[model samples]
Target chain A: MGGLTVNTKLLRQILVGFVRDEVYKVGVRKGVLGLSGGIDSALVAYIAAEALGPENVHAYCMPYRTSNPESEAHARLVAESLGIKFKVIEITPMIDAYFTLTPDADNMRRGNKMARERMTILYDHSAAVGGLVLGTSNKTELLLGYGTLHGDMASALNPIGDIYKSQVWALSEAMGVPSEVIEKKPSADLWAGQTDEQELGFTYREADELLYRMVDQRMSREELVAAGFDAAFIDNVARKVQGSHFKRRLPIIAKVSNRTIDRDFRYARDWGK
Target chain B: MDFTVALAQIKPKLGCLDDNMALAEAAIEKGIAAGADLVVFPELALTGYFLKDLVPEVALRLDSPQMEKLKKLSERISIAIGFVEVSADYRFFNSAVYLEAGEIRHVHRKVYLPTYGLFDEQRYMARGERFRAFDTRFGRIGMLICEDMWHLSAPYILAMDGAMTLICLSSSPGRGVTESEGLGSAAAWQKLTTTTAMFLNCRVFYCNRVGYEDGINFWGGSEAISPSGEMTDRGAILEEDFVLAKVDGGALRRERIFSPMMRDENLAITVKELKRIDREKDC
Candidate 1:
């Protein structure tokens, strides 16, 4: 991880092209995304606005009642800087109504519900605006399955899915994302005081190194331990990755024919185009 | 002796052999007009890089029609270009061919096929058995395709075989940026070519392509380094360019006389060391 670096300028150029080509190839010129005032979403919005002009890219700041005010302000700042269409969609009623029905629902269930509701609103807006939904989950989160399924994980196209969370910060700074958002502690804004690191039991930097060794280098558990990593930490990270394997791929469709969907019938995203 | 070389930094469309051949033909005409003795193109210029599944379909044989056209073009000016070589046994190789006066002068299959990071060359192409230099009209010339040049042994083998000019064809992507070096890939290449030329005391020419294919952008910072590690010419980044540089055999001789690095190098000892390692280890 010492020499791990990225050419932010080149990455920006490639991602801009990725967002543009990936969306326009599917017969759409407009893109819609949730701007959470976090590094990942901010980077996506910046790229989307650059790819599909600021006019074509739509940003929605769907904040819950308990969400930090600074988050909304920062999201608005991003929208203004990019000069894109912005909306403040209050998700209070939606989450509160669900809580009213299931008053004993835990924080994890409520958080998942909020994530799904935000994505639902995004899709509804995508339909109204005739744009595709752009995803903001980075590689680190996707690998650890930190995202809620069919929620924040849902996207018609993801330009930054392959870039790790650490790389996301690099690109964000290079792309001129607000410094305040860049330096803040990352959180899902799921509950009142839930920081992502505190919840995950490891820092993004630590997790990225472990994941890079395990996934990219294909290092064994013994190799990781020998490389000066904690054995228990390695075990925990490996178990999390193994358990979350299903979150990264398409739903398993039991094969009944020679060419079942999501198998042999699968084609590239830009197949026809 | 002096040899005039042309570095043709071009963007080749993936999986389109006929179009790429046409492009090469046009570049050959330009090189001839520029009075270049040898024109070098990027690795896999005839088929483009990152041919994951399209390698077999676009691969050509030694007697391919495209090779014939290139041979005909070489009657005017010598040409060195990269292509996928198909063997009789159905194995494909990432290879390069040097043509002069309508005949194949030398064929070099890339010895080191990079399999790490963004590269997956070993999956599609067979590895070359050895590295060697062959005779040319200007002087003895050596050819390496992309990753082959990265390994010191490849160039050393060629230099030992009396190669005066080393031509490396590459399709390197622009990646990693440090404040001091600018584009990390280009900077690393500058050091690699210059150091290899200085240590081996032979002129080195590196030609890389520019353009996007499936999200990866190949930065075209093609360059020519003199025997003394002096850069003769460098191409623009992310653009198509045809640059000319003179490789001076006299300068190489002077450098060799002054430094005599090749004379000091002990190939016999290095060979023994490698053999010992190989016998002791599975690798």
Candidate 2:
């Protein structure tokens, strides 16, 4: 309803149905996700809670010591409001333990480590709840490859992966997601003072509009430029989308067999059961 | 000549042929119970959509046991269902078959296999080359599978062949949204179906599948549109529904008299113009 205007209520029903059907296909009626207190994960929680029922939705607020306390508070607010299962898992200990061994690790490496650490915990806990780990990556981040793969990107199911961030914000508000979660500055909270816009170098508002043109509308570079996008802006967005292609796909299988995996012997993820 | 059609808007588990076959049998029983003369299922209703590399694995030859079972059921009431058709040459096609009176009536291979934007039909299935109209108890009927209806000429060719009703089977993914509508795909489909019905002066029974195949949700909303371009009956959105459309044949007859677009059609001139354009483009 923001960059891409849609009937948020209808979109919500569709996404809820997506979660409900996808989870049930695997013979589970439960969903698990990291609640980062950001809109993306909060929105997924709201959808999942509605789909599998709040009793079946398990939420973990995994925060590092340096991670914003406000994120944890907002995550609590969302879980309480939805009446879902909520737990606060401190990621600081594990992340700190890893950084202790590597001690001179850069902020980028540290951030990636925290993400992977959370992924390991989330997956391990997912087994406990017997629920699928729901992904929180929106289309904007997924296209730009902004999240760490096999980390925050590892999910058994992702309802928000197709909707853009601006759309996430809009949908979150429509779905009665706590304004405390929706109105906050978008962040991964991998490190202190980290906001998504600061790291991405562009606001989702600008990126979503540009992406709506470049990706969804399928506008060419010249057409995008003609439609009021600067060369620099287009180049940055396009490069990030192209560069992060690996994050969006399965690991490449080498073609050696007569019928190779992913190359010729491709079956849908929904193949059979 | 009023007739009842049960729009079998059922969610199929992808590539689960036996499961879907069972589901189909139950739906057929439901339709028969509802006193429906015909039961229509969405495209790829037998094996489900998004088969991809599993296309060959699930494809049913016309004489396969699966078709034999469906043909047997047709003895009670008519059935129109979508499946991957395996030809004798081993070529596979996204096909729909009409079974009536325990006989295989018509098999319509999808002409336009959409390969862009979440669809990969062309990568797996062979393209159908023709649009033909065949006789049924209901009268002359034309069947088009999904993308075939997107091409304006496909319906035109069938109309020219004297089909009174156009049965369009689709497994359309729910996508795009506007303030005015829930799904842009559904809105686009309405526009296409109604216009084709209006201009072609025929009824359109658009049967679309429901449920998720991967993340792409097929919005159900299976509907029956009159020749006057009105949605006489529509099913539920994003949910399975057994929508019963009481199609009054008088609507088509009355609409034909009023607009007469079909009556005024000149195929000779249209074909001549197309040939001229083709020859010029060839040169």
List TM-score per model, in order.
0.78, 0.96
Residue-level lDDT tens digits of model 1 in B1-283 = 7778899998787778988898899998888888888899999999888787678888999998889889889999988899999999999999999999999998899989999888888977899998889998978889998788888889999998889889999999876543333577878888999999888998889999977665566789899998898888999877789998877768978998998888888889988998999999985
Error of 1 at B62 (Å): 3.5
What are the per-candidate TM-scores when only chain A is compared? 0.97, 0.97
Q: How does model 2 score by TM-score?
A: 0.96
Candidate 2 residue-wise lDDT, A23-131, digit = tens: 9998888998999888888899999999999999999998888888898899999999999999999977778877789899998898888888888888998899899
In candidate 2, the residue pairs with backbone N, CA or C atoms under 3 Å apart (3 or more residues apart, or in different chains) clash, namely none
Question: DockQ values for all predictions?
Answer: 0.15, 0.70
- The digit string of per-residue lDDT tens for model 1 on A43-124 reads 9999999999999999999999999888899899999989999999999998998799889999889889999999999999
